[model samples]
Target chain A: MSNPKEHLYQKTAFDLVSGFKNKQWKAAEIAESFLNRALDTNKKLNSFICIPHESILDHATLLDEKRNSNEDLGSLACSPIAIKDILCTSGISTTCGSKILQNFTPYYDATVVEKLKDKDALIFGKTNLDEFAMGSSNENSFFGPVRNPWNLDCVAGGSSGGSAAAVAGQQCAASLGSDTGGSIRLPASFCGVVGVKPSYGRVSRFGLIAFASSLDQVGVFTKDVRDSALLLRIISGQDSKDSTSSSNFVPHFLDSLSIKKKWRIGLPKEYFQQGLDSEVRQALSQSISLLGKNKFEIEEVSLPHSDLSIAAYYLIATGEASSNLSRFDGVRYGYRASNPKNLNDLYKRTRSDGFGYEVKRRIMLGTFALSSGYYDAYYKKASQVRTLIIQDFQKAFEKVDLLLTPTAPFTAFKIGEKTKDPIQMYLTDIYTTAVNLAGLPALSMPCGFDSKKLPIGLQLIAPRFEEERMFQMAHYLEKEFHVQNSKHHIVL
Target chain B: MKFDIQTVERIAELSRLEFDAQEKEILLQDLSKILHYVEKLEAVDVEKIQPTYNIIESECFFREDQISVHLSNDSLFKNAPEVQEHFVQVPQMIASHE
Candidate 1:
């Protein structure tokens, strides 16, 4: 028989919920198994910045008591979910992998965190991330980079790398991550897990520390599409706290999973051009042929403005980042510089000492972009170009139901591989950023593993608030690909 | 698109950040490279397209201005670096003339 510990950790969140409800396993046993796994693998993966070991067990034990008393249980009764460090967790430090907020703890929980608690999901831990969610690789984190579980030397894609790695490493049943300019999807692609970035206002951003307001979104990283659907339903809805949140009807995502339809999948000709790794390209083509044989129409579509996405994304993301991050001045909370001669000295010294290199670089870029003379040329021009990119997606979707592309140009690269050159690192998000620009819903799931045994992710982009379609297609393709059966060759 | 030391310094001042000489040199190179790349946006034909300042098309949501329970002072100051009686402490804003 398979090891009981291994079997417990391997079960998906859906399986865990059903098994716990049926008394197959106690909630404490499930929590202990995953928590121990997280603690055991954290040394190798560095996925969690803070794993509140005792509190998680206490919460799990409370669930067991409720079940024993014949009390009604929440939908996610005994599920263990890891949260990205960017979200505020009451009494737990929400570091965002930066020294700026190292000792800071919020008095209130983020809207998503509160929702998860209401559903009785164990708040497993706070996962690591790029400092202020700035970098394409987790190397920019102050806590050090999160190593990819598949290959220890390769960097887990970021700034949600820790959340992705935690799910892939079996450290948590699911995780919550924020995506601004491909943070969630790129790491999910690299780590071979399901990463979903809902449309701009699909989820509330109230307690999520802002990176770039227009593009920032709270999303999920899960082992399977069903778990993604389940978690997405629980955390999504209109919230009074976040004005940008949509009032659109939040559907029952889990109930719609079995609905099948042949979606017209578009392959953007520009995304298929040079720079895509041959192995990833081959894997995508194979997946395409499989879909084509299964009656899904595949066609070549043009997103003419794709080449300009990166330029526009950087100008806009950094410009907003500069303004949003201005809150970190030596003030009421967070790190403060020592021995300041005056208020201005304190502001400058505290920020300089607190922020990591990438955060400072982006701040400079944003300050320059929004400066008096250059605003029209840089930020305004990029915003206008963003309109064209949005229009490009609008026109493409008029002909196709969904778009398919390689999530990243290549798989996870070695740590320190592209850190020396900021531009080289920024180019990694070439295929994933435009989706954010248009505020569309997209997901990344494993298609195949490269020859090196590293996971290759295929991204599916659907129109705004049409996540249900993306889920149906991804779930269908996931079964066809037998993604669940694929073994993770984790180093630890 | 290239940034000189003086320009980097000006931007850093605006951003309230300080960098030593070597750090400034590196920032100058990195910012120059990134800005040069983004300069390509000038070539895109966007004269007709309106800027998308806000991607969310939702209307502004307003709520009642009613009194409600909020975080107490103790909880609000829980994360403050330095706190005095019901207030956050910081460096002296006004310098005394010597």
Candidate 2:
């Protein structure tokens, strides 16, 4: 009835798979549609760093031929999924949005990339991100800032900003983003998409370029809650390569979506108490009331140490980042300094020239924290407070099935709004950081829009390894909120 | 604590980074402000709590000790600034040449 291009470009990945299964369209046709859309708008949005046209079409053509011959098709038979540049794809550059690894191509796929391919999903392209997932906005990217599709003057939140913008712009049906602190959810909230930060160790981190080893987790951004669940089910499972990946059985996440049991949602008193935008607060409270009307119990809970989350998180993340990022010296691989006089110059020049401002700042902050006399005063104290933050969540979950909060303090600010003030930028993820510090699962979905028409994100966090419950609650919330089809209306 | 230029320079040296004079001045102020903000952690009274460096309960996972195929020299040297036969070349380590 409508122009088929609209449906083709905007269909949920689930429907697209169903469309392919019915022989309604060839895999090549679907892949071509997405590639064309991505190419059409990437310049305006700056959502992608590189789009390998030849490789993507070649893979799609092979998939079409196999489909025509009636071969076994995987879940994402023809679906095109965008990966944040941080994920390593074999033979493609995994830059982690830094100049140091600009030309470095990986020889093997990350565990998640392998899983996506195993399910026959097309590797859409590498999306831009904050360099090494450091900054809260995508402006830190070496490529450029990822403009929010809804309002080009505004920024798409980072470090998964490019992935969020790509999904928001209809460049891809869905995408993968990484959340260290609020990387995925912050951007998703800004771009009006569903982003999930799965429980730590729930998904293997074998090939995710480590930001903060303990806090970094791979997550998905999609048009709807169900696609988030589908991707989670596919990518999660124990990988022997990632020693931290849980050996527990990966639960049937998609199957849990149909179970419509009402949940007891906790509204953290601290989250609502301060620094929340009035409009954003109004929308989150509306979503909570809608849940209460739908028979879900709502109760006020306390995370007393919540105010200290940002401080502790920055210390721990940078300390871990300092240790994790030390491997990128001149000799091994990636960008090496041009002409160093000696070994020390080689190390100094390579790192100084290779890393950007925010990366250097964090590395130094971490070095200071972990340095000789300061270790007990800084890093050690922060880690101990980290224990209290974890215990707070553990205790809160005993009272409620999930805790709800705003994914970020405000909607997408204008480009360069918070860049000059690093503290202002860091405060954007205040509510989301504590979840990562505690190692929990959370999701951000479009609840409503602010006065500027930029989307507001509602965050729902669950206990560790309880992603099934997280998905169940988010699925129910989305249905109740009736915010259906609030996706991909990019101005470009 | 005041993060003076000397402290910034020392920390940068420890981090194996060498910033220009202007950048160092900016970093001194930025790091001082950020560190001042992070001073909130010291007030949390972490007297008896044990630091949690990891979340997973599993001890060090032991994979079978097996020699297998690793990355070939070509891929390993692919991004090297300078490469010799199957090896990455770098500047001389000692202060004086041999």
Candidate 3:
């Protein structure tokens, strides 16, 4: 008989939990299967920065012991989950894909890490990311870019690329990612997985290394919609440590997944305009036609300020990034400069040597925007534009329960294709950045595949704090698309 | 929208970063292209709009002033580059009298 552990790595977290309850597989067996798969795939994918093999197996063995004692277990009991390196893990090296923190380890766990541990989820490893979560493609990482499972030559979309790639590659059951201006959704699209970016303040940011305090949010990357719901429920809630975390009730997201309703979905005309790939556009049209046949009212809507999102997002995001990233002075924690001539030399050289090219570019841009004479002309103007973008979404939601759009303009591109031109790279987030600007809950799920067999993603965005509505709609569409079984055919 | 070397240097100083001449030249080109793109924000009229610094509707919360367990000095200093008896070492700030 084939070893049951052989295919355990392919099972969903939800199915793994059920199997555990049925006494079919021990937690240690599941952990070993995933760990073996992860180690074997890391050489090609470069998805994980570090994989703690011994600790993961030990944690799973402890969980198996608990099961033997007939003790009640948490929802995620023994499922192997990967975390984006930006979040602090108490004893593990939490490098945010940068050389600066190569040897730095956090003294305490992030709130999300604590929550996952409480649910008995085995955090097998920390995934790679664009350095400081800056770029649109995974190419900006200091370690190396994560290779797309669908097409090895192409990039897995960024700053959360490794998180998305880990799930798509089946190295981990699910992974956590942080989204700031389409980081999670774009990668989800490229990697053909379900990614959710909850409304701002929906999840606590206590130990998530700050990229843009206003825009950064913790999210999840999963193989399917139901797995996304299960993971999202476990990691979301208010914490006294993060005052910005909403006290709004955290509903059982999985329980609400099957409640089908003929909700109105809006397709913003501007999102479907020029620059979108022909195949992606066709996929969106097919999905819309299917929705129409099912009696869901669909209509064209206008988000007039959509064009200004990239401009405003870069300004505001980089502005906050400049201020937030100033803490890495190299004295308290992380890499420190050697043989500094003076204090100024120490600070300058430490940052200059620590940060990568893209990071320095952003810091310079943000500093210039917030500099003494240019404050009103840049930062204030962008903030006003941000207000208008938020208003655009609010107005659209008045007519429809949710909005549907292509998650990205196209499928993944060749790794070095857009790396030369920063503008070309920034434009990759054109459709996805607006959702973060409005602080709305949005998710990207695979709706169809391109002519080349690369997955195409459809984004459904709902009003702030209304994640349940988004999940219900995505789950419905997921069933209709029947793309659930179309897993990535990457030969490990 | 073109940024010169001096302007790049000034901004880098403010950012507490340093770049060599080649890197600075690239930054100049990149910053110019990016800021020129961002210049589109100037066309929008914002006469009456309030700038949103944050979207959280609730007021700032204050925790109760009770003594609680917190990170110990040992743990806090564990990641410090140079630590000696609970003090983080750094470059000398004041000029010594000759």
Candidate 4:
């Protein structure tokens, strides 16, 4: 019998699925092992807000029965995956990390959840997130901040902080996260994992609690690139429930990963500006050099409007957030205030009591930006600037096959450092937010570590429908950077 | 224009939120700074530019809407704070004209 601890805890999704296929481990044994490890680690990491103990074991027994009979199985048959609370799971509490929806149990699974279950993946528990996916740090979560696995003093990036921390700390094989701005990539970077934010429309947003409807995209956090690609292939596709979902055929991302890289990659000058820490910049430069030696050409490109991305992102994101959140009126669903005398009172008291401070702040800013007299002056004009930012990426893509940038300006800071200053918190997304505005696909891979041994991510971005090219480059860099097995390499 | 106390209160009311006296004072100052920065937008010439919303521009793609089984009324009201006759109860809408 295998020493089931590490195998159960931190095995990559790819390895686990392959093992399950060969009947090397029974599904029940695998599920129990992970559940045990998750329960043990969650105490320190606070990565999981809910763990579906009884249901997961029940599902495992069924999968083990199917395996013993030699029945054909789905892709993720018996593999464990955690979901950020933002995605609704049928019969499970889908809080979106807000008190407003604390008691709300979704009657239907989101399209993504339905697909995951159809593939036979175990629905692990819901993870914590910023209330409504608003904050860059997980501290804004109503359940309490999720601690970074790499260092307990630091924070796991948010609003997908719980998912990233869970995956990083061996709580799950893979976890799904939503990235409206940098929620997915930021946490993935800080937690030292592979995160891919698929192109807008790649994944269905049918039941995800909306943050910025246009910008919000669901992504995955995995211990390895191949696992990320596998999860991406499964979750992506058009859906009738989501209008923005692309009708295009879902690419065979696993097959795409096999394609060799023989193209030019651009490093944006604006991303490597003065504020970037020298160590992080060096890590990116070294990665570029490694790629150069491997026959991939690298060049310096300019995205002049890049500096305005943070401002424009905040305006556009908050403006849409304001509009999307208006549905929580304490009338149709979710929380209702205690003895609300009137409709307006119900709306006010419910929202005031349900939402957290950061959520309230964004809603206010968004409402102000989109208000009648200021619409043209703020929202519309910010959109034009957003267009300019998109053009910057478009113009650069013409000259290079892909664009490269640091995933974040600096490495993850200590918890409570940025809590007081909201602007500084927003600034953490400086590099990752631009891609959301442009509707492009991007991935954040671990590039280097800072002086304190925290991970820094180098972002790889590609043009529309060019995720294949982006993956090819990422695979090459994964080898070139020599970052493999450097952090959290499970030897079991 | 910079937002005064009255403007702030009005916007707060419009947003269905409450702002205390100190918060209103702070909001006034913050709004002034933001408005000053956002004033750059006025210089842009958008006379002929139509506002662009929904960049993807997809038509509604519905499922086979042949009564594809709706949620049970019990499940719908399971989390409701107030329910009456299998329907969610809310405060009556008091019309201004009425």
Tens digits of per-residue lDDT, candidate 4, A330-409, equal 88778888888788888888887878777777787789899988887788887887777777888999999999889988
Question: A168-271 in candidate 3: lDDT tens per residue?
Answer: 99999999999999999999999899999999999999999999988889999998889999999888988888988998899899999985678899999999
Question: Ranking by lDDT, best first?
Answer: 1, 3, 2, 4
lDDT of 2 by residue, A1-492 (tens): 436457576878898888887888887788888888999999899999989989989998888888889999999888899999999999998898998999888888999999999999989999999999998889998788999999999999999999999998999999999999999999999999999999899999988999999999999999999999999999998887899898778888888886466778898899987688999999988888777777788999999999999999999999999999998897877888887888888899999999999999999999999999999999999999999999999889899988999999899999998988778899999999999988899999999888888999999899888888888888877887674335424567
Query: What CAPRI grade goes to candidate 3?
Result: high
| DockQ of candidate model 4 | 0.46
The chain B TM-scores of all candidates, as shown, are 0.88, 0.82, 0.91, 0.74
Native contacts matched by each model: 0.91, 0.83, 0.87, 0.37
At residue A51, give the lDDT of candidate 2: 92
**Tell me, what's the RMSD of every candidate?**
1.4, 1.6, 1.6, 2.6
Which interface RMSD does candidate 4 score? 2.5
Each candidate's DockQ: 0.87, 0.79, 0.86, 0.46
Query: Each candidate: how many clashes?
Result: 0, 0, 0, 0
What is the TM-score (0 to 1) of candidate 3?
0.98
DockQ-derived CAPRI band for the predicted complex in model 2: medium
Q: Is the docking of candidate 4 incorrect, acceptable, medium or high quality?
A: acceptable
- Clash count, predicted structure 3: 0
**Clash pairs for candidate 4:** none
